[model samples]
Target: MATGTVEHVKFRNRDMYWDIAADLHFPPGFDESKTYPAIVVAHPIGSCKEQTSGNVYAPALAEAGNVVIAFDASFQGASGGEPRFLEDPAQRVQDFSRVVDYLVTLPYVDADRIGVLGICGGGGYTLAAAKTEKRFKVVASVTGANFGRLQREMAGQNGGVIQALSTIGQQRTAEARGEQSAVNGFLPETAEAAKQTGDIDIIEAFEYYRTDRGQAEHGCVLFEAAHGTAVLGWDAFYLAEELLDQPLLIVIGDKDKQGAFGAYRDGHEIYERAASADKTLLEIDGASHYDLYDRPNGAGEALKTIVPFFNDKL
Candidate 1:
C-alpha cells in the first residue's frame, strides 16, 4: 500500500564520526527538479529505522505528499558508533539536527520546510532538539517518553536511586580498568516471559520488537550499562517552557498504562509547558502506548491529524 519510492541512504554524523543508515521515502511521482518539504522520523529507544519510524510513519507521511527520512541513531542499527548500543541523550538529540543538515544539502529538499516526527523516546529527543535547532519548523511526537524520568522512576522502583547510581559507578570504574562493559536488556527474551512479569507495557513491547510483528535484526533491545549515567542526567523537556517555540503536536494513547514508562504524562507535560504559539495535545482514546507504534487503529488514526499538521505547518 505504498505510494512512494524508498531509497537506502547513508549520511555522516559529523560530531560522532559515524555514518548514519537511513531510508528516504519520496512521494509518488517524486521529481528531483522540484523541491518538497521533508520530515525526519526518529525511532524509539533500543530501536532502529526499520521499526515504527521507517515501517509505519515514514511511508505514511510520504504517501501524504512529503519526503520522510528514518535513520538509525549513531550507535545503533546500521549506523557507525563505538561501544555499541550506547544510548547517549545528547547524541540522540543531535542526530535530528544532523539529519536536517543532510536534508538541506539535497537540492530537492526545501530547507525552510523541514520538520520532525518522533516516536517514544525519539519523541522526547525531537522536542528537545527542536528547542534550539530551529531548522525544524514543525515538531510532532507519538507516545513521547521522557527517558530521564523513565529511567529515574524505574531505578527507584527496582532499587533506590543511590543504589542504582552506585552500581553504574562501579560498572564504569570496572570498564575503565580494562574490564568488559556490562550491557542491559530492554525487555525479556520472549513474549511469554514478558507476559509473566504482568507489566502491560513490557508485554506489548516484546510483542512488537522481539517478535515478527515488528522485529528487525538491527532493532536489538540492548544498551551499554555504562551509558546509564548519561540517560539518568538528561532531561528531554529541560527548559521547554522557555525555548521550544516551534509549532508542536503531541499525540498519546488515552489507554496508556502509566507505570515505568510515562509517555501519557510526558505528552501532557510538554503540551502544557511548550511556549509555542501553535501547539496541540491529542489523546487517542482506546489506544495503548505500543498500539501507536504499528497498529492500524492506533497509527492509522494518528495519521489523520499528523498528515494535515505537516501539510499546514511545513
Candidate 2:
C-alpha cells in the first residue's frame, strides 16, 4: 500500500476551453503550513492519469517527500472538451502550463521549486512546454517521444505525408458536412492481436493499456482521425536547441529496439539539442520503452535517479 494521500481535483485549461481532471498526491507527513517542492507527471499518449502517471510515478514521488500531481490532458479522460478524443500537440503542451497555474495557487506548494516529468509522448510535450514555460524550474523525460515525428514517420512508411494530409483534409470536410468524425485506435484491440504483428512496442502497449496491468476505464487509446494533420506537423523539440535552457534529465531504455514508436533515438537527440547548461541522459539497461511506464526494471529503476535529481534540482 502507498503511504501518501490522493486528492481528486479539476482545473480549467484556459487556452483549450476545458476542465482538466487531475490527482494530487501529498507526502506521508504532509503539513499544510509547509511549502513543498512539486512535480507534474504527464501521462503518455492514449493514457490517463490513473495509469502510470497517477498510479506509479505520483505515489512514488510523493513518498519521496515531494508533492506530485498527475493529470489527464484536455479532451480525454474525465477532462471536458468537445470533439472528444482530439490529440492536438499544441493543446497538450499547453496542458502542462495550465497544470502549473493550478499548482502555484496551492499554499503548500513551493512555486519556485516546481518541476515536471513526462513519460512516452507526454515526455515530448514536457520538453516543448518547458521550452517556453519558464515557471517549470526543472524538466525530465522517461522514454520521451515526439508524437509528430512518430505520425510523420509512420505516414511515410504507410503511404506518404501528402497522402496522409489529403486523408485528414477529406475527413475534416466530411465532418463539416455533418458526418461523424472517424476515430482511430492507437494499437490493436487485444494483446494477442498486437503480438501477431511482431512489434514489441505494440505488444507491450496493448498489454499495458488493455490488461489489468495498467488498464483504467478512461484509458481508451482512441483519437480523432481529422486531427492527424496537426500531430504530423508539430515537433515537440522544435525550438529546444535555442530555448530549452532549464536543467534537464532524460531517461531511456538502452535495449529499446528503436522500433517505429521507440524513444531511444529521440532521447539522445534531445540530449544533444537542448541548450540546458545542466543535463544528464541515463539509459536503463535491459529495459524497453514501455518498461519505464510501470515495470520494476523500468519505472522503478528510473525513480532511483529521478527522485534524487528532482530533490537536488528543485
Candidate 1 has an lDDT of 0.90
N/CA/C clash count, model 1: 0
Residue 176 lDDT (model 2): 92
Q: Lowest lDDT 10-mer window, candidate 2?
A: 10-19
lDDT of 2 by residue, 1-314 (tens): 24678999988745656799999999988888999999999998988999888988889989999999999999888898878888999889888889999999999999999999999999999999999999999999999999999888878864698899999999999999999889998898766789898877888888888888888988898998987888988999898989999999999998785556869999999999999999999999999988899999999999999999999998
Report the error of model 1 at residue 202, Å.
1.1
TM-score of 1: 0.96
Model 1 spans with C-alpha error above 4 angstroms:
157-159, 257-259
Q: Which regions in candidate 2 have their CA more than 4 angstroms from the true location?
A: 13-16, 157-159
Inter-residue clash pairs, candidate 1: none
RMSD of each: 1.7, 1.6
Q: State the C-alpha lDDT per candidate.
A: 0.90, 0.90
